[model samples]
Target chain A: MAPTILILALGCAYNEELPEKDILGTVIVPAAAATRLQADGTTATDPRFIGPIFLGAYSGIDTVSFGYPHPSMGPIVTADTPGDAFPYGGTTVGRYDFACYESLACKVVTGRFSDYNDMLEYFGTVLGSPIQDDNGADVANGSTFQQACYDYFYATSDQEMAFLGDLDFALNADGDFEAAFVMPHTVFVEGMTIWGWMDAPEIVPANPTESGGFSSCDVSTGREFDQYDENFREGRVYFDALNTPSQYIYAGDWVASGAEEAVVNSPDDKPVVRLDFGFGVGEAE
Target chain B: MRTHGNLALGALLALSGLASGCTNVRDGFRPVLTDAPFVYDIGELRVIGAEELAGVDPSTVPDAVHYGQLGAGENAGLYGGATFQFRATGSSVCVVVDPEAMFWNKEISTQSNTVQYKFEDIFEDDGDLDLSAGLAAYYTGSPGSEIGDFSAVYDDPAGVEHELAFNECIQTGYFGDPAHAGRATVEYCDIDTSLHSGVMYTAVLETFALPIDDSILNFGALAFDGRCADLPWYDSNGALLAGASECVIPNEVEYADANGIPEEKAWFPELERAYCSGVGKVNTFCKDNPGAGCQSEEEL
Candidate 1:
C-alpha cells in the first residue's frame, strides 16, 4: 500500500486581501525572480517552463510594423529575417495573442500606440511599479525617465533595485497560449521555479530608416540598419533574453514567444508574495 | 501629480498658440475655429525617422485634397493605399473612411544571425544619446492584440480590394503590453479642408495600409484641409453627416473593452453637442451606446 503523508496547514497569511475594485489590474509576474514555494520540478509545469503567462491588464490590442532596414519595410511575402519586413499577403502575418474576438466575448480590438500622452498613462497605470520608485509616480516622459515596476510586478517610482530580464509573454494555440487571461493577484506561484523570469523591459524598436519600408519614427534608436549591432543596444533593454541570441518567432518587429508558469508545490501552498494586483494603487482584486 | 504636468503642458501649448500657432495639443492643434472644419491629411507624411520629420510643418504635409504616394507604400502591396468619399449635401460634409488591423502576429522565424544590427540608431556600444536624440519622437502609439477576428473590409480608391475595420476610440482595457501605445485611434489624424457656402466640397480620403507584422496590416486613413475629421460619421454643420452628428456610427467605430459599456447615448457629450471628439479613439463615446446606430438585430 502507498504511504500517505499529511502535512500541517500553512501558518503564514497575507498582510491584507486586495479589494475587488482594482479590476483595471492584472498580474505582471506571479512572484519575484525566484522559485515558487512548490520547490523545483516537483509540479507539472516546471524545468521546461509551462506558463499561463500574464499579459498585464490592457484595454485593447494592436499590431505595429516590423523593423527591417528601410529597404525592406514595404510589401513582401514573409519576413525572411528579423530585420526585414514581412510580405503583404503572407498566410499568417500577425502577432499578439488576442484573447477576445469581435463577438464581444473578450476585451480585445485593433488600436494604435503612438499617442505620447497615452503611452505615459499606460506605463504608469498598466505597468505599475513593484521594484522601487521614490517618486511613486508614473515615469513615461521622454526626459524624466524612471522605472515603473519592481521585480515582483507592482507600481514603483524609483529604481532602487536592478531590473531583470525574461522572455516576452507570448504564445500560440499549440502551447495553449493563444487564449490569454488577465490573472489577478490571487494567482499564487511563490515557491515554483520560474524559467524565463523577466529582468528587463521588452522595448522592440522599429527599423531606423524609411529605406526599409516602415520607420519607427519616435520609438527608433536613430541607428540605421547598416549600423544595427545585436551585441550592443542603442536603447534600454526591456526583454533581456531578446538582446542575446535566442530562438523567438518574429516577422518584422512582432515577436511571439512562448513562456509558461510553474505549478504549485501542493494545493495548500499559498503564494509567498501577497496578491497585489493593482500594485499600490487602483482597487486590488 | 501627472494631472499637474498635463496642465503645465497644456498651458505651454496655449502659450505656443499665441506665437504663430504651432502649438501641439493632445486632441489637435489649437482648433482653427474656421467657418468649416479645417481638413488635413497626414497620409502623405513620409514614414521617416524623427530627424527627417523634425523640420516638417503641419501645413507643409499632405492633405486629403492633395497628397502623393510618398514612395514607400506607393506600390499597392502591404503598404497599399485606400481612398474615401467626402460627399456633402446642404451644410453636411460626410467623409467615409476605414480603420485597418489592430494587431499583427509575426510569421515563423528562420535562423539568420548572419545579418547584424546598426548601432547608430538610438545609442552606441557604451550607451549615449546620438545626434538623433528623439528619433522615436514621432512614434507615439502602441499595438493592440485580440483573440478573435478583428478584421475589416477595405476598398481603396482605385477599385482595389483590402480588409479593414473602423476604429478610433481607445477603450479602457483590462490587459496591456508595453510594446503597444494603447489601441491606435488613428495615425496622427487631422482635418485641413475648408467648407464653403452652397459650394459642395468633397474631403477625399487617402488611406494607406502598412504591413507591421508577417501578414497583418496597419490599415488607416487621414483627412486634410480641416473638415471635422472626428467620428466615423459627422456633419460640419453639426447636423450629423448622414442624419445627425450621432455619437455612435455604424461599421465605423468600435470599442475594445466589453466591460467598458457605454453609459449614456454614445459619446454625445464629447461629440455633436460639444464636438470635443477628434481623430483619435474615444471609447467613452461607445459606452452605453454600443447599438446607438444599429437599425435592427440584423445590423448588430
Candidate 2:
C-alpha cells in the first residue's frame, strides 16, 4: 500500500533498570523541586525529576522497548570520559564516539525537558529544522501547539517528572531539551516512498569523537526478490523512518482530541502501533 | 369478471419477475458466474512505476503492492493479511485463494486456478462495511449493466464545482478530483466449500478527488474555525499535525468539509451529521489505538 500515514510515539520516561545516558555523563538525579506558575493563579509544585521520556499516543519501534537488539561495544571506555558528556563533545577529540559501536544506549534515552514542547524543540534541533506555527510564526519562543503538548505531557506523566542526579527536568528545564529518540511513523512512510525526499535542509548536530573513534554503525544497501512469490517476484524493502522526516516538521504522537481516554501510555512504557496491510491472493477477473 | 381480473394480475406479476430474474440464482444474483470469467472490462490501466520504496528492506518482498491508481495524491494498495494463502500468477494482476471466503463457505471452489479474480476481490474479506460494500448494500441493479451508463464527473479542489465528465467508464482517475468520476470494479471471493455458502457479491467503489456538490462538505465538516476546543490537527500521518485551530467557525455556515468524508453522509444534512458525528469522534478514538485509524476494525 502506498505507505499510508502511520503513527509512532516515543515515551520519554526514566526507569530504575534503564537510566538516561549520553556522551556527557549518565543522568544525575534531581535534588529539589523547581516551582512554576500554575493556571489556577497559584504556584505549581513538582518533585522535579528527569529519567523517563513521556510518550504521546503513538507507538515505538527500531528502539529498545520495541524489541530491537542492542549492539555490543568492546572495552573502549576506560576510567576516563563519562558516557553522559560524550554527546556534546567533538568526535575527533577524546570524546564519545558513535563510529565503533553499532548500537549504544545513549541513543535510547536522554535528559527530560520541563514540558513535551521542549522535547519537540529538541527534535527540531536534531532534524535541523526551524519550528513554525500555522500562521507562519517562528514557534521557538512559544505557541499553542507547544503549550498544549507541554500541558498534555505533564498531565500524562501523572504530574511527576523524572530525574537522575543534577541533570533532571527540575534543573535542566530551561532552553531546548530532548528525550530518548524514537522512530517516528511519519518518517517511516515518507522514507519508504520518497527515498528521504522529506529530510529538511539543516545540519544535524555532529557526532562526538573519542580515542575509540565514532561509535561503529552498519549502514549498507542492496536488493533482493521475494521467493515467496510464485516466480520470486520481488522482495519488500522496509526502513525505519520514525522520528525522521525532511519537510513540515513536528513531533509527538498525541492526537488533537486531548480526550483523557486517549492517553494510552507514558514514555517508560513504549506503545505498540500496528500497520494493517493485508494481501488477497485470489482470481483475476 | 373477478376471475378474469385475477388471472390477468397473476400474469403481470410473473412477467415482471422473469424480466428482472428475481428468483433465478444463476441469472438473478450470480450472473457473472456465467461463461464470462471476468466481469468488469479493463477500461483504463495505468501503472505508476515505483519511484521510491521507503523503509522497505530491499530484501523482504511485500505481500501486496499499491501503485498510483489516480492522481498525484491518489493511490491503491493490496491487502490480505496472514490469511493470504494464494500465490500470485506473476502477471500485471495476481491471483490467489480466498481463505476468509472459504472459512465462511465451503462449497465454493478452492483450487487457485479454478477462478479468475483481481484486486476488487480483496474488499470482500470484511473491511470497512460502508465504503467497501459499494452499491451492494446501497444502490440496486447490476453495476455491470449500468457501468457504461453512469456519468463520470470531476470536482476541483474547492470540491463544489463539477469540471467535466468522461463518457467511458475509466477504471482509474484522480479520486475526488473535479475532472473525474467513475467507479473501479474488481472481483473478490467468499470461499465456499461443502460446509457453507459464501457471500458472493460484486461491489463497486466510486472515487472523486473533490466534491461534486455541497453534499460532500455536510458529510464530515472539521470545523476548521479553531473552536474545536479539545480537538487537534493531526497530520494525515496521525501525528498531531497542527494545534487546535485558533479559528473556530462562527456557525455551521462557516463549516466546510475536508477531504476523506464518508460517502453515505455526503448528502442529506441529518444523515450526514448523524453519520459523521459518530465517525469524527471515532476517528479520534482510533488515533489513540496506535495506527488503528489507518486500518479497519478487524485489522486493529
Model 1 regions lying over 4 Å from their true place: A1-16, A19-261, A264-285, B1-32, B38-300
Q: Write the per-residue lDDT of candidate 2 for residues B83-171, one digit (tens) a residue.
A: 11111112211111111110011123346322211001121212110112111122232333222112224332212223222111122
B194: Cα error in model 1, Å: 36
Interface RMSD of each: 18.2, 26.9
Residue B271 of model 1 has an lDDT of 32
For candidate 1, the iRMS in Å is 18.2
Candidate 2 lDDT by residue in tens digits, A1-285: 333322222233333443221112111112211222222334333322111222211221112211111111111111221111111011110111111112211221223334435533433443323344334444555345435334523433313433111233333453222222232322111111110011111112232111111111112222222233312111111122212211111121111111222122232333221111111101100
Q: Residue A14 of model 1: what lDDT?
A: 34
Instruction: Please give the DockQ score of every candidate, comma-separated.
Output: 0.01, 0.01
- Per-residue lDDT tens digits of candidate 1, residues A13-47? 33344322111111233322111112221212211
Q: Give the 10-residue window scoring lowest on summed lDDT in candidate 2 chain A.
A: A85-94
